[model samples]
Target: MTTSASDKQKSTEPVTKTENSETVTKYSRLPETKNSPVRRNNRRPQKSFQGSNVSGPIFQYFMTGDDAQVATTPTKKRPSLGSLSDVGSSFDGELPEQSPRKMTICEAIDEKFSPVNYSACSFTSIGLSPVKHDKDGTVRVPWTLVLEDRNIAFAGDSDTLCKYCGNVRDLDLSHNDLQSWSEIVKILKEMPHLEQLNLGQNKRLSLSYDFSTLVQSQYTNGEQSKAEKPLSNDSPSTESCPGSEVNDPQTEHDVQKKPPVSLPLTLPSAEGLRGHRDDFVHTSLKTLVLINTGAPMDTIAQMLPRLPSLEELHLSLNGYKQIENSVMKIVEPHSRVKTLYFTDNHFSDWRDFAKLGHIFPKTKNLYLACNQLPCIDISFEGVFTSLESLHLGGNKLDSWDCLDRLNELQSLKSLRIHDIPFYANYDPDPTIRRSLCIARLKNVSHLNGSAVSPDNRIDAERFLIRHYLDHHPKPQRYFELVDKYGQLEKLGEVDLSPIEQICLQLHCSEMEICKEIQVKPSITVLQLKTCVSEIIGIGLKDFNLFYKDAMMEEAFGPVGCFSELKLMSIQLSTAGLCDQSELHARTISRHHNAQRQPSR
Candidate 1:
C-alpha cells in the first residue's frame, strides 16, 4: 500500500515553500483537479492509522501560488471535543453525511450581521469591518466588536480562526454568558490594540481558584502528542503493525526514566492565567468596564497591578457595599485611572470616599450616585481636589454642610446633589436652593444636571446674601454680603433649616393636628409663611403668624420692621377660625376682617 516519490509527484498538487513556510510532509496529496483523466484501477485508497485532524482553509490552507514545483499536503476530520472516546475506532461503513455543514466562527459572526437573520443567535451592536472572504464562507478579520448580551460562548483558537490577532481596539461583551475569566483572557490576548473592554453583567465570570488543573492538562497533552507522532520516513518500522515498538526494552526504560512532571509550587499573578506558554505582559487596554461582574476582592487585587495602563474603570451596579482599606490600597499603584464609575454602590461612610480617593488618585470624573452616605465631614474634603465632576445624587446626605464641602474641590465644575434629605425636608423653593448651591460652589458650571448661567449665579448670590442676613441677624453679615455681591438684584426667600430643627405650627383645613415646623433658622417669618402657603396652597391673606399662640403680637411684627422671631411657641392660625381647636393663641381678628399678612 506504500506509494513511492514518483507516484507522489504525479498525484499531488505542486508545493511552494517560502522563508516563513512551515514544514509539511511532501507525501501528502490533494484532491483530484477537474481536468485530470480518471484512472481505471480497481485498487482502493490506503487508509493510514493516523488520527483525524481538522485542517485549514480555516487552519490548514495551502494559499501559496508558487512557481517552484515541490509537493502538496492533505487534511482530515477532527477529534471530539472535551473527551476523546472511540478516538481510533474503525468506521468501515460509509460515514454519515456531514450534517448541513455547521458554520465557522467567522461565518457565524458574519451571518449574525447578515440582513437575512438566518443565524440562530441573539446579540446587539456588533460592529464589524469587512476585510476579505475565505473559501470556507467566513468573513475577513474585523478590528472591533460589541458582543453585549450575546448568548455565545468563547470560540476555540481553531474555531472562527481570525488571521489577525492584534487589530482589535475596543470590545464590549457586557451582559453575555462568558462564564469564565480564563475564557476572557484567551479572548483579550488575541486583541492587542484593545483600549476599552466592557465585561459588565457577565455574572458568572470569576477568577480561577488555581491553575494546577490547567497546567496538568497541558502536561498530559504534550506527552500524548509526543507518543503518537510518527517515526521518520527514512527509518521505516521493522514490525508489521504500527505502534509495535511498545514491547522494546529501550522504549519501556525511557518511559520509566522520565521524571514525574508537575507545575510550579505557586504561580505569579495573571501569569497563572490560562495560556501560560506566552509571556503575560499586556497593558494595551486603557479602559476596563466591570459593572456587576461580581469579581471578588482578591481577584480585583490581583488584576489591578497587572493593568497599569488602565485610564478608566467602571464598577457600577456591583453591589459593593463595602471595600476594605487593604483592598483599596491594592489599586493605588494604578493611578493612571482618570475616570471612575462607582454608581449604585452601598458606600455608607465618608471613609469610603477617602479610600476611593487613594485608589483612583488621578480620577477627574467620579460618579457616587445611589450610595448610603449619611454625612460628610470637612476633614476628608481635601482628598478630592482632583475631581472635576461629582455625582452624589440618590444619597442620604442630610445637611448643606456636605454641599459646602464642594467648594473644597478646586477642579469641580459640575455637581449633582439631588434627592438629598436636608434640602428635601426644609428648602421649599428649588430655584432658590439651586441658586444657593451655585453661589456656594462658585466655580461649578452645572448643578443638578442644569447649566448654571450668569443670571442664575447672580440670583443665587442674592438668595445667599438674604439667607445670610436673615439667618444670622448680624449687621456684620449684611455688610459682608453687600460688599461681596454688590446689591443682589432680587432675592428669592425659602424657609430652609440652616443648621438644626425649628418648630412652627400650621392650621390647615385638610389636617387635624398641627405639627412642629422644619426650616432653616436663617429663614425669615415672611419666608416661613410663604413656604407654608405655597406647600399647603392656603390663601396668604387668611393665615396669621403669631407668637405664644395668644395671637397678641404678630410674629416678626408683620415682617421687616423686626428681626427674625424667637418664638417660644410659634403659632400659625387661620383668622376667624372656630373654637374647636384649643391652642395658647387666641383668634382676635373679627369675622369681617382678614388676618395680618407678613411681608419680607
Candidate 2:
C-alpha cells in the first residue's frame, strides 16, 4: 500500500512545484484530510498465521510471470504432531520405524534448516505464536510483521503464513536490532498499505533521508518531455549540441537540461533522522514519534513542515537546552497539530513558550515540568485560549506575574504550580502590615475574578507558608510564648512542641506571623486574650510600651523610642529583689537625676 510518486503529488494538490527548482513550495490542508485517498491507500495491513486443525501436508504456490515458465519450490505445510500417524516409516516400509510423529508449529519454526521461508511470501495479515524464537535464539514473534498490507503478530518466532491479512494500517517493530532505516524503508516499500510505523527503542535506525530532493528530481525528470521546446532560428545545428548525434538543432537543444541536485541517500549521523525533512514532504506520513533519541533540533525543524497531517508529537527526555525557536516558526504554519509534550528538558525561559500560542493555536495540553526556568514572563493574554491542561510544576519562580497574565486564559481547566516559592517579605509595623495585606488582597481579588475557584485561596495560603518557611528564621519562641500564656488556645491545643524547640534553638521570631496578626485587629485581640494570664507582673502599660519599642526597633533601630525603652526595662529587671518594689517609684526620679547629673 505504498504511495506512488504520482499519488503523493496528487495528495498535495493545489501545491505546484515550479520547474525552475529554485524555490521549495509549501502547502496546507484541512483537518478532514485524514480521510483522504492518499492516507487510506497507503495504510499497511496487519499480519497473522494461526490455525486450529492440523491439516495434512499442503502446498502453496505464488506465480508471477505471464507465461508461467518459472516454478519455484512449493511451500510445505506440516501437520501438528498429534495428527500424525504413530507408525511412520523411518527406514523402510517393512520396518515401520517411527521418530516423533510430527513437529509442532513451534518446533517447525525453531528448526534452522527447515525449508520454510515465510519471508518470501507477501500476505496481508499474520498472527504468530508467542513461544516462537528466531535464528539468533531471540524471541522473534513479529512485534508487527507486515506481509503486503496485512499485519501479523506471532506469539513466538514461528514460521507461519499470514492467511487472512488485509492492508496494514499500523506496524510495530519496537524491540529489534533492525539497524538501518533502509531496511525499514525496504520493508515499507513492499507494504504499500503502511500508514503508521513504530520504530521506538531501535537505537541504530533513523528516518533521515532528504526525500524532497528525490521527489523533486523524479518530478523534473517526468516533466522533461513536456518542457521541451523548439530551438531558436539562430541556434547551433543539432549535431553541435551536446550529446546530439543528429544535425537537427531542435533535438540538440532538447538534450541540454540541467541536472538536478543529488542529495546523499545515507544520513550524516548514525541516527538516520537527517533526510526525514524531505521524506515527509514527498510521502504521506501523518504521525511520527521519536522519544529519547537525540535527534538534532535543526533536523526536526526542517522536517516539521513536510508532515501536514501530523497531529501529535512526543519528544520527551531529548536533552534539549532550549526549545528551538525554529520549531515554533515551522509549526506556526501548521494548523493540524493539537498536542505536544516536551517534559524533563532544559528549557529555562518562558519566552520560548510564548510561541506556542502562535504556532499550535489549538493545542489543548502542554506539559513542561522539571525544567530550569527561574521565572516566566508570559504577558500575551489569551495566548492559550484553547489550552485546557498545563503542567508547569517543579520550577523556580518567586513571583506570580506569569500566573497573573494567565488569568485571561479562560479555557484553562487544570493548572499545576507545584513546588514553587509562594511567600514574600513581611514587616511587623502595623501600618506596613496593613499595606502589605491590602496589596495582597487586591492581587487575590484580581485572581478571584478569573476562572480560578475560591478554593484557590487555600492553595495560595499553602504557597505563602512554604515560602516563609524557606526564607524566614525559626519563630518557635513566639509559638512557645503563646502556648505558655494559653494565648491562641486553639493553636496551642495542637502540639506546639516542634515549633517551640525550633524557636528556642534559633532564638528568633518570624516577623511574618506578627505582621499577619497586626494587619487584622481581630487577630491582635485574640493574641492579647490568650496571653493575658501569662502577664502576672507585667503591667498592661509596660507591655504596650514594650510592644511599641519592639515594633519600633524592628522598623527603625537605635534612634527609635524602643532603643531607650529597652535600656530602661533591662536596668529595672536587673535591680535587686528587695529594692524591686521601690525601683518603680525611683525609676522616674533616677531618670531625672541621671539627666541632671552629667552630659556624659
Best by TM-score: 1
Each model's RMSD to truth, in Å? 20.3, 27.3
Runs in model 1 with CA error above 4 Å? 1-131, 134-139, 158-165, 206-277, 472-600
Q: lDDT of each model, Cα atoms only?
A: 0.55, 0.41
| Per-residue C-alpha lDDT of model 1 across residues 84-136, encoded as one tens digit per residue | 22221223476533212222223334333432222221112223324444554
TM-score of 2: 0.38
Q: Give me the displacement of residue 168 in model 1, in angstroms.
A: 2.0
| Poorest 10 consecutive residues by lDDT, candidate 2 | 499-508
Q: Give candidate 2's error at residue 549 in angstroms.
A: 45
- For candidate 2, lDDT tens digit of each residue in 348-406? 87776766567667777777777777755656575766777777777676654555455
Highest-scoring model, lDDT:
1
